[model samples]
Target: MRRAVATVLASTLLFAAAGCGGDDSGSATDGGPDKFKVGAIPIVDVAPLHLGIAKGFFSEQGMEIEVVNTTGGAAAVPGVVSGDFTFAFGNVTSLIVAKSQNLPLKAVAEGNSSTGQDGKDFGGVVVPKDSPITSAKDLAGKQVAVNNLKNIGDTTVRASVRKAGGDPAGVKFVEMPFPDMPAAIANHRVDAAWIVEPFFTTAKNQGAKVIASNFVDAAPDLTVAVYFTSEKVLKEKADLVKRFTAAIEKSLQYATDHPDEARAVLSKYTKIDAGVAEKMTLPAWPQKVNTASVQTIADQMQADGLIKDKFDVAQVLP
Candidate 1:
């Protein structure tokens, strides 16, 4: 088993030097000093990455990964831009915002996407069991909690509210981590929360009720997140980049083929109980980049005033 170097407070941890372990050593192809520092949140979307580490798919490619655990995608941005992390995971909305601000980054691989069908849930808005704010329109002049401000959660919720005959302009959004959302709703700290699994599963168990599926009406099958790296890494480490993505694709396939095993790995990395991990709605892993789906988000963000301009999706692809 490959043990990753772990760190807290978004601090950096060095797992292994590029060619420090294992015996190929003749360059990465000989199988790896192809070491990577990655920033990620401990959400179920990242199960495939953990699976890759556990199965040694990266090791097979002569690469090693040191995962930097973060609380949200916004927190991971600076680290990736400053080269503290060679790669990181983030929502597509956040990435688009970053690109609009001229951040030199590229998305090397896809992460989790919404399953996009009736009665299927990837993300939703939750309210207290007895709250009078029973529908999206009730959210007007109300505070809604989201993990990151001006990203997927905020954009999707606003779109959803408008579709539900509510005034999206009147709703106020606040930033709150997923773990704290259930309690926030219980205590009336916030009126509602935009959340995803396994916290969605956890919140429902805590007496919170889902008001609406966040994406189904606004934009179904949305590409929620991706694995990205700095522009410098894209230009300077071409071979290593290719190898890294190949490993990611393989890991995604592994997770799809062995969901139970993937959930087991998720429990090891996240605080989720085995039962919650088993019951949570897993994210769809798309290996190929969907420019059109990503464009849909960029267009939405621009309309929502979350970003200044629509960006070229091709510029972010690796």
Candidate 2:
């Protein structure tokens, strides 16, 4: 059985939230029953959550967490807003867009923040090893595959291309899932693919080289991934939020301190090779959500016309 340690404050938060009639609750403040449900995606960036579960961090916090795997951020947000899950992980852009649309969601904690080290910004445009395209400039009039059009992969690629003195709109963007990116490249169906996670590693293993990483051209502190909860959940279950955040922080500390152990845990959940998990660059663990970092993403989304209105970062953060 996994063992977890909880902070006194977090325990209090859980009780307070539960007492307010949040959901079905049989748990006590001191490790009695399962209480909250957390939804997540399979992306490697959510390593800390997997690590926390493996290490029993949430269990120690007196919370029973239900982990649900969804397609991506687009699907996760609605579940969070509808109270299907108490919390969910999503891209910062998605959160900002939701906020602009007056969704009841707010970010309670930072899930992951990118840095250039170890390919932390592991997303970029890549072509087959033998492709004639040599640079971002060469992508002109070429077809590029993005996991989702106008999403993180595509938006970052567009920014990078523009920074490289290439036309951002020169290349046509094709939508494809990360898992299918390699086949697309191999068939010459697309000149290059913008990808993240297991696909990035897989593509590299298959002789696809990156032309540029988003970190090279985009804002380094841009909010990439985060933990968000609905406003109703926040107002009624502040304690649960605190408990979750505390457990997550502990899990992150453990990951940073015991990388080998963390990688082992990640491999089981992500099915990523142990060696690949070890090689993948992960974002820094934040103690709480950073408002400024989130605002940067919101600003970018507005500029990209992904959101109709600018949202105040503070209002969106718990």
Candidate lDDT values, in order = 0.77, 0.69
**Candidate 1 per-residue C-alpha lDDT over 114-188 given as tens digits, one digit per residue, 9 for 90 to 100:** 778644775689998888877787888999999977778888898789888998999899988888887888787
Summarize candidate 2's per-residue lDDT along 226-259 as a digit string, tens digits: 7888777677777877888788878767777775
Q: State TM-scores per candidate.
A: 0.88, 0.84
User: Residue 81 of model 2: what lDDT?
Assistant: 58
Off by over 4 Å in 1: 1-33
Extract clashing residue pairs from model 1. 18-32, 18-33, 19-33
Give the Cα RMSD of candidate 1: 6.7
**Which candidate gets the maximum lDDT versus the true structure?**
1
